[model samples]
Target: MGSLRLTFACGDYDRTRALHEGTVRPDGIELISLRLPVEETFFRMMRHHEFEVAELSLSSYVKSLDQDPSPFVALPVYPSRQFRHGGIFVNAAAGIEEPADLRGRVVGTPEWQLTAGVWIRGILADRHGVPVDSVEYRTGGQETPGRIEKAAVDLGEQIRIAPIPEDATLSEMLADGRIDALQSPRVPSTFRPGGGVRRLFADPVAAEKEYFTATGIFPIMHVVVVRRDVYERYPWVAQTLTKALHLAKREAMANLYDSSALRFSLPWLIPGLEEARALMGEDFWSYGLEANRNALATFLRYHHEQGLSRRQYAPEELFAPEATEAFVI
Candidate 1:
């Protein structure tokens, strides 16, 4: 038979670039990669299953796992990983000096169970002693008006979450002093100069490094997933895709370390890369479930504790059986 043609959608990340550029191909499969913004890819995939395979948000993927037949099964390839300590923003005038001050305050988020929000809330509660339920949660578009949750999220009574009014976006609320803070993966446009907003951490890079030093976690924002039906029919696709991603990421990582020439659009990139290597050690951005167990477990815990998932899931339960294990030479 000829190669199976499939629709794949994900962000444009260096690790997955080889797949998009046709440098790596899954065995007997041809990919038509749709390089859209991550948010567009996610909503289309989750709500509509718009592609045969796509990168998925961890929180919503787990929410899918709770259904009788989960919508998709994942590979260990994490295309988007970020340290979320810098995602929190507060009104410059809110008097929110630290995380503890968030208690008894109103916090707005695009989605209550957003992966970034999960980590930020978990860090606030676990590391800073600010309980998740201690504050009221509001939902709305970060820059535009009236955004709503895309998937089903039932956190039940301990927490209170409400939708933003039709007239205002979360960023507007933050700027106008209606909400004390906003937690989002992207910076709200309103926070630009004279916008009356500021990040909770004045120096977020230093804060993120401090957080990494303490927790040994660089939060994973997205994982590659295949529709369950596609996996059920072409079972080999799971392992094939997994292997291809590993090979692609290896090339990406190797390229980033070439000190003779700069591979990215930043100055002093070599020293910055060296500093990261020195701090995170080798395998800093590893794939496969085993290498990321602690980070995955930590995220799942936050997912469950925030009531996004019905129950906490171990890393093994979250991915295809073949994805969790591989032979490395």
Candidate 2:
């Protein structure tokens, strides 16, 4: 039989470039890769199951597990990971000098189930003194108006969540001090000089490094998922695609450390890579279930604690069993 064809949508990260450019094809499968914005990819995939495989928000994926028949099954392949200390933007006049000061404040988030928001909230509640429900959460668009949660969620009465006016945007609300703080992966327009927005942590890099030291978690933002129907019909696709993703990530890491020439625009890529290796060790951005279990478990715990998930979920439940292990040579 001919190789099965599958549509895969994901961000154009260097790690996934090998797959996109046709250098790292999955075994027994033909990938029709589409480089789309993360938001668009997520919205289309979650709402309509637009792709056979796609990168999805970790938190949103967790939330979807609460559904009686979840629409997707994940492969422990994390396409995006980032420490979100810098993602917390606060109004200058809000007097939010520390995370603890966020108590009883109005915080705007693009979506309650956003991976970045989940990480930010979990970090605040875990390390800092901030409780998950201490602040009132207002959900709306960050730049434009009328953006809704890509996945439907109702945290119920215990956690306070409200939607902003259809005509309103989080950026403008944060700038005008309508909301005291905003948790977002994207920087708001009002984050410039005299724009009345500043990160809660003045030195986010130092704070993030410190957080990693404390928690040993470089937060995972996205995971690769196959539509449930596709997986059920062709279960082997999970492991095959997982292997391809791991190979692609290895290629990107190899390129990152290739000192012959700069692979990225950053002038100090070598020093940065060296520093990261020193801090997090080689293979810092590891793929698969075993390497990432702690981080995954922590995130799942946070998701349940923040009332996003219907019940606490174990990390192992997130991915397909076929992708969780491989045959030894």
Clashing pairs in 2: none
TM-scores, one per candidate:
0.96, 0.97
Top lDDT hit: 2
Model 2's TM-score against the true structure: 0.97
Q: Lowest summed-lDDT stretch of 10 residues in model 2? A: 320-329
Candidate 2, residue 184: lDDT: 98
Which candidate wins on TM-score?
A: 2
For candidate 1, what is the lDDT?
A: 0.88
For residues 292-311, write the lDDT of model 2, one tens digit per residue: 88899999988898888988
Residue lDDT tens for model 1, 97-160: 9888899999999998688899899988988888999999899888888677769787779789
In model 1, how large is the Cα lDDT of residue 289? Answer: 78
Positional deviation of residue 301's Cα in model 2 after best superposition, in angstroms: 0.9
